[model samples]
Target: MKIAMVCLLSCCAAALCISRFAIPEAAAKGSHSHSLGYRCPMHPAVLQDGEGTCPICGMKLVPVTASGPASDGSLAVTPDQQKTLGIAVARVERAASSRMLRLPGRVTPDETRVYRINAGVEGSFRDVAAVTTGSHVRKDQVLGSYYAPAAVNTIQLFLLNTAGYDRAAKKKSEGSLDGENVDLISSNLQQRLIQFENLGVSKRQRNEMQRTRRIPDTIEVVSPVDGFVLARNASPGFKFERGMELFRIADLRRVWVTADVFPQDAPYVRAGMPALVVAPEESSTLSGRVAEALPQFDSQSRTLKLRIEVDNPGFVLRPDMFVDVQLSAELPEALTVPTDAIADTGLRRTVFVETAPGLFAPRNVETGFRNGDRVAIVRGLSQGERIATSGVFFLDSETRMKAPASGATASLTSSPDPTGRRTSGGGAGPFQKSSGDMQAEEAAAHTSAAALR
Candidate 1:
């Protein structure tokens, strides 16, 4: 009897142990199991298991799988799956810097320094003394001579009258000895002399002609100032009228570079701003300050005209020559980034910001003025943030592929009903049961099982 009792105790202990372990195992069997895997967004051929990102794009790993098949025939992606893809990225930074803007412009003569020599009387061109267009001449230098018979005859007549009046004044003074008559004769002589001088006859020439009893035929055309001759219109026998331009001279010691800035940029350009001008054909650069900005906009080009004065003592800068102009101004300090780093999609501008290792999030940004290689960021970002500078398009494509398709149907399951008829659950058909009903059934099954135990 003792042996049989001991055996029964052992059997009871074994049964109890089996019941405890089997119940837990059976309960766990009803629960769903999942596997983890990672993939590269750019290269789908690369796959792995881990909590890391794609090697190519640095995008964080998405959950390997969930409960359904991916639209592209791959397993469903869970929140923890990591995908590696190749990509390029850059870090945002700040430093004291200046922007350089290059523009094409031309060199022009300063209006204040250029001189136009015009004809003073109607006559035929006799000779051109200053032969070349760029020849330098001093003030009062005889440029050319012209023969005007009408002017010459008028001067001769005036001189002859002056001589006769002088003789009459002397005789009146000697004979009358009357102060009033003598003063009248003297006044008449002075009037004739003034008339001759008004006709361009010099005082020295008048005295010599009066003593010699002769009048010069040709009139000398003199330069008004010391400058280089820009143009000459006289020939050996060219006829000229009064007020006709005969020559054009300009002072080359200073030149002007006229820049045609667009109306939109006119506000930025102001007088007294420093600018640099580069000749189109020469390597030398000239520096100057903005002298003035014309208020009116060009009717055809719609551009604002700005003048910059530069010294050209060597006479190297020529009028109408083309040049490159650079205008710079101090700008307010602000956040800036490479222009290539931002992705512009017409409607919106965005940049992919690095949140963590292999993790990036798209951020919309507002931009301001743009310099040569960089642009000012007005909003939506801060300094010292890592952003994808190059190859962002590939990452974007991968993100789209990983996202779930909208309006897609879920998978369905079939099971036997109490009446032996097959019923379907979790599908896109009209007969599909509501998700709430499924949850309720799962809850009831757990409760009933617990009560039975």
Candidate 2:
């Protein structure tokens, strides 16, 4: 009887030990399962109260928290997860936004100051000038002389008409000729003078030819402007057709620098805006004003062209030379944030605002001008709010995954689209079920199991 009592006491102690450890383990497992729900990893929309195969993709479901979505349509992200994802954050503030554009430039001569010298009549150069290309010449300076049969014929006609006019005048003075005859002779003479002018004979040369009563063999070509010769095609004894180009002259007192500005930067660049041209070879920076903003962009580079007029006092800027250009603009002070902080979906632009520690909610915002690294916020946010800048795509993905949870408001709802139109966000997704229905289903299943037992 004593041994039986000892065995019974040992049995009671073992049962107490099993209850102490095994019961709590079972309870802990039940608590964990109750707090979590299951969904197909392949399809986050297929959420269920318990683990099961996905109806659509036929993939095994994974466990997710039943309370994943917060009341304010925010998603909770732990600090450890943020660190692992390399997420970075920044604050919104108010300041004057500015942008600086740097672009490659090329020097070009101003069209208004450039002149092309061409042969006035059919001729061969009798004598070429001593000056060559790059030589500076003064206005009215004789560049070369050319012999043309038209010029000789024109001068002869003028001399003949002058002689006829003189004879008619003398007869009128002697009362041998009528006034009508004298007037007719004078009109013919004026016609001959105009012909001489058309044949490249200057006023002084025409007058000399008439006074001397001689026809010159060659006509002198003179420069119309004081400038440097850009091109010289004159050669002695070389036959040339009328209106053929002989020389190109350009005044380099002012020049144009064509710079390529990107399309995004084109809006701020306008005529009369100040620009700076950097000549690395000359070791100087020249100030200029935007002469024109070209309407079209280059097909290959996709950049807009800007014409800048700069005064070249020492003729430092030359055609076809490359240089650097700087353009800048300042926008009015306003609320701004880093450009990367905003996530643009095709329909609307969103920003994740840090509502609480480790919690972020999406806010729809309207953006103004985008300056280099930052953008202006026109509406929907206040200054001094912190936002995720670096890991916005990851946050967006997390939000999308929790969007189908019933009674869990998703931040992607009821916001103004880019066009300032309000959109409704009151409807539930097709695959979503309310938490109450899921709870009722689980209670019914438990009752069925208890009755079977």
Candidate 3:
């Protein structure tokens, strides 16, 4: 019995000696703890004491600085780690934005500038000009001339009446005029003038006849507008009635471009909005403005018809010419971020907002219209906050892996020694819960207490 007691005392003394001296030396000489070390949030096996990126998945190592309490699931990356991960950040900005709507359409002539030439009097074409479709014409330029007998007789009557009036005026000047005869001559002269004017003779032509005392073989007609010939019906010898159309001319200096706008984009298309037209034939772009939109919407196409009036200064745009149109509209000031920063995970849209220095939190944001490379944040984000613009995938992957693991064991208890050192006596730090316990908690939350006193 005494030998047994001695042996037990010897074993107790040896354990005390090792605990006081040898265990501490072994701990100091061996590998280090993870209290200040960093590891890959994706693969905890990839660990380092300083900033680094994981070789397996190329994810940045996150410092497990958990000597304190558990995290709220926000990822804290140091400046060195951010640089190693190639994370770039930008601040959310508030400014006026503009949206450009690109549409395809075609150009045609302005309807108001279109002119149709018609025959003024029944006559045969005698002197047609050297012209055809697409010929350029100027105002008051003669396109063709016709010879009619009535036009000749009409000129003769005017000349004879003017000669008679000259004789009657001479008699009055010599103090020998008959007053009744003078009124008769004046009435006849006015009637002859109307007949000549009705035959398409101008007053200037009449004055020329009176000066030269001779009439031309044919009366000429002129174009009323400076334009290009769109259609020509009359040939060198074609006969036509009084109201027959000879040519259709249109001023090509200005044109109208029409496009069909989708219903989603129709609200921004208002009258007077400026537009730019680009065509393959033109070396330069044409400037235009929205003239009007037709009242009738195309139900089958689900589109609204839009028209824009553009100035074809060089006559580069032509009827039936295809073109591309760009229309711009102003947008109200709103918080905006880079469009590439948003991550769509099928169920939610999220961005990495830097809640603190080198710390990013996954923010669920509602998005609005996208203007170029920027997107408007309709909700869940505020102005002046910085967010990750590049390297978002890494941040997303790291946060997702760490958040669930930390939450899985948050309810476990912890113990501390006399020296205030945490001892591994529980499942995990106070930031987790097992799956079954979590399920029970959620179920109890949905149940109701019917008999409350």
Candidate 4:
């Protein structure tokens, strides 16, 4: 009887131990199995309890792990995952900034240095040098000679006046002519000399005429300045009327480059701003400055015209030649970041800021000026903040997935229901799941809670 009592007690103790541990262990295992949920890796919006392919993207669904979202709606990504996604980060800082503007330009002669050769009287070229357009000529170099009938008459009148003045001076010296009469004759002679000089007679030629008291057959046409001929209308025995152009010359020691700047960039460009001109075909670079900004934009191209002056020592820069112009404008100190960091959604601009290691949050930003590769942050950001420079697209997509209420995420918060009425507050947004999907999510939520417990 003693042995039977001992055996029964042992059996009862063993049964109590099994009830306390084995039953709860089995229940917990069952709950964990029911708590598992599947989600598409690419399309996180697609969630379901059973494992299958995503209906939208056709990607294989993976089990959704029990990872909780951050309290501030920030998304946490692992270092390994960030590496796989190619995320790059940069720090925002205040510093001196500048922008480079590249524009097409054309080389032209300086307007102030261009000269047109014309005779003041009717004439015809008796003989012209073999010079044509682009021929170099020096100062006072004889380009051709012309015969003007008008010039001959003026010279004869000047000689007659000179004779009368001499006779008056002789009489005044002999005390026969009065001072007033001699002065009047001298004045008339001066007027005749002026008329003769106006007839294209140089000072040397006038002196020679006064000494010889005769008229030359032809007046020599000479270049007034050293330059290259831009146009030549003179030929042997070619007749030209008064005030007609014979040649066009330009001193090409300095040249102007006309650059067409976009209307939006016109504000930054001003006179005296430094610029660099490049000739691709010549493989040459020349420094220049903005000479002037045209008052109006082009009527056809709608671009503001800028005149840049540069020196051409070897005549390398020719008229009508195309070149590239680079203009640099200094910007005031402001918070700036790489241009790739900002994600523009048409309605708003957002940037993914790395709040902590492996954590990124979306921040709205007001952009001011956007230069190539960098942009100025006018507001909604501060210096010393780290932002994602590249792979922002993935962060943006994740932000929308994790935080639908984040205003700058650009995810719509409302959609029309079956009744054609729009509802606010996360009601079937672009990425939101349907009612049927909500049922699956509900089941997954229960499973997640069970797993957590």
Alpha-carbon local distance difference test for all models: 0.60, 0.71, 0.68, 0.72
- Listed in order, each prediction's TM-score against the native is 0.58, 0.62, 0.54, 0.70
Measured on C-alpha atoms, candidate 2 has an lDDT of 0.71
- Candidates 3 and 4 compared by lDDT, better number: 4
Which regions in candidate 4 have their CA more than 4 angstroms from the true location?
1-51, 61-73, 78-90, 164-190, 193-198, 281-283, 292-296, 345-348, 355-358, 402-453
Q: What clash pairs does model 3 have?
A: 408-433, 409-432, 410-431, 410-432, 410-433, 411-432
Q: Write the per-residue lDDT of candidate 1 for residues 244-301, one digit (tens) a residue.
A: 8887888878988877887656656678988888875777888888885564567887
Q: Residue 346's C-alpha lDDT in candidate 4?
A: 88
Which sections of candidate 2 miss by over 4 Å? 1-31, 35-63, 71-73, 76-96, 130-135, 157-197, 202-214, 292-302, 332-334, 343-350, 356-359, 364-368, 378-453
Query: By TM-score, who's the top model here?
Result: 4
| Candidate 4 worst ten-residue window by lDDT | 15-24
RMSD (Cα, Å) for all candidates, in order, is 20.1, 17.0, 18.4, 15.6
lDDT by residue (1-453, candidate 3, tens digit) is 645533433433322222222122333454335344454454443444466544433334445433321265566666765675577999988999779899887888899999887775777778788778999999878777777665777788778888898899889888899877888998999998887655666555677888887977776766768999898876656677777888889998998988778876776678898999989666578889999656348788777768999989879998998999999977879898887798878899999888888777888999987788888899998888899998676666655545533443222223122232121322222325566644543333223111100
Winner of 1 and 4 under lDDT:
4
Better of 2 and 4 by lDDT: 4
Which parts of model 1 have CA positions greater than 4 angstroms off? 1-97, 153-214, 262-265, 280-282, 295-302, 354-359, 382-391, 402-453
